[model samples]
Target: MSNLPTINTDTIWAILQDKISDEVVNQLVWSCLGYIYDETKQAWDISKVVDDWGEKYPEPPDFIANRPPTVKLTRSIPQENKQLLKEKLGFKGYKLGEFGPRETRRATAANWLLSYLETH
Candidate 1:
């Protein structure tokens, strides 16, 4: 986690320029740039075990098209006012049955940024 926002390719290259391997970057792209691995042989083979990937999905989905949009609370409210709002509100950041690795990662990263900004 970092104080910086979640990234895209240009930002990633700008931040990581010359400090990484192409192999690792490509693997990361493969893992995160959205595709499903279809391995029928493993599912068909008696000797091999097949996994459903345990309900996990690619974040950007060439697989599941159901990923929710990123949310932004863009208004700049005073800290005291924000605190008051929080005290008055009971809000759901996520809906039931919508939790996934991608969602958790996003929430955790944003939380990290918020905490870091508060501290610094």
Candidate 2:
């Protein structure tokens, strides 16, 4: 994986939804996707990315920048902290434990989305 801080959209699909909150997934996905598209001169669909990601994220957050977002959920977010996470990443579609296909705390959330959200 490219580790230049500019995460590729294709590389971040699974990272987007894997047992994470919608806020974290969206931010990380968008930030990485932004690098792939806007920074590295690649072309892709943000709307489709978001949609393909899952219905949990009805839409990307309003604070998104023209460039990818800088806040990375994994590295930055502490482990096993619900309220703090809610304050930071927002508790939109959060769940406990590892997620399963067609079986999750949040029924609307998609397990495959994270896997497909990546570009490369």
Candidate 3:
């Protein structure tokens, strides 16, 4: 039910494997678990816990930020048109459907392209 991002246990385990001592990991996990399960606190902050851990120890690589950007080619394009677009645009680092802040020209252009495709 929480809107917060889910923590990856596998990544945590990977980081804990050889980076930090078992005692430290156990202590941090127990502290966070206590805050989460405690009847009165009614709050949890995995990010904060991880950040603190990173401050005291080696930081883990940020997995989410490392994911490659993807774009949805929303329409059926003719080979000629696709090649033409590629030639003109040099298709790189574009995420078609994932527009961020519609005020930007790139986002607006993508929106216009989608609308144009939908109409055709």
Candidate 4:
């Protein structure tokens, strides 16, 4: 059988704790999903904003630009990786019912990562 890549929870936790905040992660999730925070409306809305990896679109705004280059920003985690993270991190669903309305998988994952860092 082939060897599987190892995940270092301690290192991942440390990065989450030291490099980024839950709020910023949430914003990054939205950015990855093609949404932008409208300061005037005080809400997130669908926009043409591009992520760091988007070469065809315009440059990322400050909210996305200011993030540490090492942070992994994506629209969604692949199923296998998500399962691996859940198993290693000992967490449940990405949905956070206590926080109110349901969020996208990406947002929920971001929120969960931050929550895990905060509580653990």
What TM-score fits each model? 0.27, 0.21, 0.19, 0.31
List model 1 lDDT by residue over 1-120, tens digit each: 113333443333322332333333333322332323447543212222112222232222221112232221212223443332123222235667977644443332233223223443
Ranking by lDDT: 4, 2, 1, 3
Candidate 1 residue-wise lDDT at 105:
32
The segments of candidate 1 whose C-alpha lies over 4 angstroms from its true place after superposition are: 1-91
Candidate 1 or 2, higher TM-score? 1
Candidate 2 residue pairs in backbone clash: 9-119, 10-118, 10-119, 10-120, 13-114, 13-117, 13-118, 14-114
- Candidate lDDT (C-alpha), each: 0.32, 0.33, 0.31, 0.40
Better structure of 1 and 2 per lDDT: 2
Which candidate leads the pack in lDDT?
4
Query: Which segments of model 4 are wrong by more than 4 Å?
Result: 1-52, 61-76, 94-96, 100-120
Per-residue lDDT of model 2, residues 1-120, tens digit only:
133323333323333344444444444445543322344644433554432322333334322221212222222223433233234333344355655432232221122222223213
| Residue ranges of candidate 3 with Cα displaced over 4 Å | 1-16, 35-120
What is the C-alpha lDDT profile of model 3 across 23-119, one tens digit per residue? 3333333343222323465543344432233333233322212221112221323334443323433334336675433212222223323233333
Q: Give candidate 2's error at residue 53 in angstroms.
A: 14
Candidate 3 at residue 59, lDDT? Answer: 31
lDDT of 3: 0.31
Clash tally, candidates in order = 0, 8, 0, 0
Q: TM-score: which candidate is best? A: 4
Model 4 over residues 57-102: C-alpha lDDT tens digits? 2333332334332133322334444454456666454444543222
